[model samples]
Target: MSDVLVAVETVSRAKQLKAATGALHEALDARMMGADLFSSRDRYALFLAMQRRLHAGIAPLYGEPALAALVPDLPGRAKLVEIDRDFADIGATPPADEPVFVDPKDVPAALGWLYVAEGSSLGAAFLLKAAEALGLSVEHGARHLAAHPEGRGLHWRRFTQALDAVELTEAEEARAEAAAVVAFRRVSRIAEETLAGA
Candidate 1:
């Protein structure tokens, strides 16, 4: 591990993940933006499709038995159903291509992927507003961006608590950080591909 990763491991896992992945998160967010994403229904649908693709990639992680033991609410957090509602509202269908996949081999890697997925909910407030600017809403569209049923802050707090409770060795921590970076990169790639073709 690098000095930065070593330093991050001293903090709570959630904080370590946020610090370690901040640059990639910002880079991917920048790359994911385009006028069409918030301007037109067609483009917005493409954006939602990209989101679905990214979620699908990590869906399997939520089902891992070891991870389930750590975070029992994991399986219920998938955004696919909500994304489907958004797609329906926009009258768009998912692309025909096979979905991208991100396989995390162990508990540490799974936690890394879950860190990205769960952390995303914290930013959904802004996305909900953006979707509203496109005339989408929690009831009619943009369900995926709707505030979590438990409230975003509370939901995130619970998830982070679970994350911090897990014990990992130095090498495992490094693997977790790498998994998070990979997750962000995969989402960025999906966004780039979707937007380029849009």
Candidate 2:
């Protein structure tokens, strides 16, 4: 079990989409920040690829129970709900269908919410992993999305912590590294190949 996927195994395969997507996003954001500060596009692109790979990888989970829970069964409501919330929280609205990074100027703002969403997913997966490690399970019932609190709070907390660690001092930021980045890439690749083989 590759670490990337392993981190999310406690989550139902259906919910894996959310976890994977979130992990990939965090990896990307971390990479970007790392690159921006270190002046290393190599590092930036590495994380960027991770983010893209994760997005591509999680495409299958659109109908997974966990994801579906957040989205309404009605057409066009599920994905849009998050987008709406993001806009509402940020007090800025981009077109519903605008590309996420088409305009480089919006990168910072886009990344803010992207990181939050992704961080939440990462946190939830971390919680799920911890529970499983302790021999527990999350029974996400039908309508779980309704019951599942938004992960934004948890994600933002982690996000701010990361930012603080990095911004405070070089030594402090080193402590905040994503120990899981390399592991995630390895696992994600294996999972991709396995899925392709299947």
Candidate 3:
């Protein structure tokens, strides 16, 4: 029998999204590296401040019914609560204002934002380890970086499965890609602005 999948793009949505934003992601990673983000308590606080901005910016997206339909656990995926607690643990308050990028109801663009937000949890595992050196942990100043109760790999797989199953229109696909780029650029910009203020 002939294979039934020949027409489908073998590339997964997760991979396509990664490819779309890889360069921007790497540039931000390099900038974070050079920022000495974990070098000391002050630097770590600045890093957390930067994180506060990014996570707060997208915190609203997790609640959109359309987006939640895509990723069932989307509400539980929010890091703002943990980030807020981390700020408290560090004796700092996250600044009240954060720039909003996309409307939460814009499901396509929101997915792009979610791509960056959710994917960062994997990297957070490493950041959590680094936070340990600064006397931070899941219970302390690094709560946002703690692993999911379901485990990181499995959690990521669930998100990817949901992402991959989405069948977006050509126009929607373009929107998603543009939004992903915007999300990365926002992170880069926020990193610069946060560190500059530091």
Q: Which of the two, 1 or 2, has more TM-score?
A: 1
Q: Rank candidates, lDDT, best first.
A: 3, 1, 2
Q: Which candidate is the best by lDDT?
A: 3
Kindly list the per-residue Cα lDDT of model 1 for residues 1-198, writing each as its tens digit: 656544443578899999999999998777666445777777788878787887777777767777888887887787877887778888888765444355545888878888998888888898888889888899987988888788999999989999999989999999989998888888788778877766
Taking all chains together, the TM-score of candidate 1 against the true structure is 0.88
Q: Which of 1 and 3 is the better model by TM-score? A: 3
Q: Model 1: which residue pairs collide?
A: none
Show pairs that collide, candidate 2.
71-78
For candidate 2, lDDT tens digit of each residue in 42-131?
322232233333333333334344333333331221233443343343333323232332122222222223333344344444434433
Q: Which ranges of candidate 2 are over 4 A from the true structure?
A: 1-38, 63-67, 70-151, 154-198
lDDT of 1 at 47: 79
Inter-residue clash pairs, candidate 3: none
Candidate 3, residue 184: CA error in Å?
A: 0.2
Give the Cα lDDT of each candidate. Answer: 0.81, 0.34, 0.89
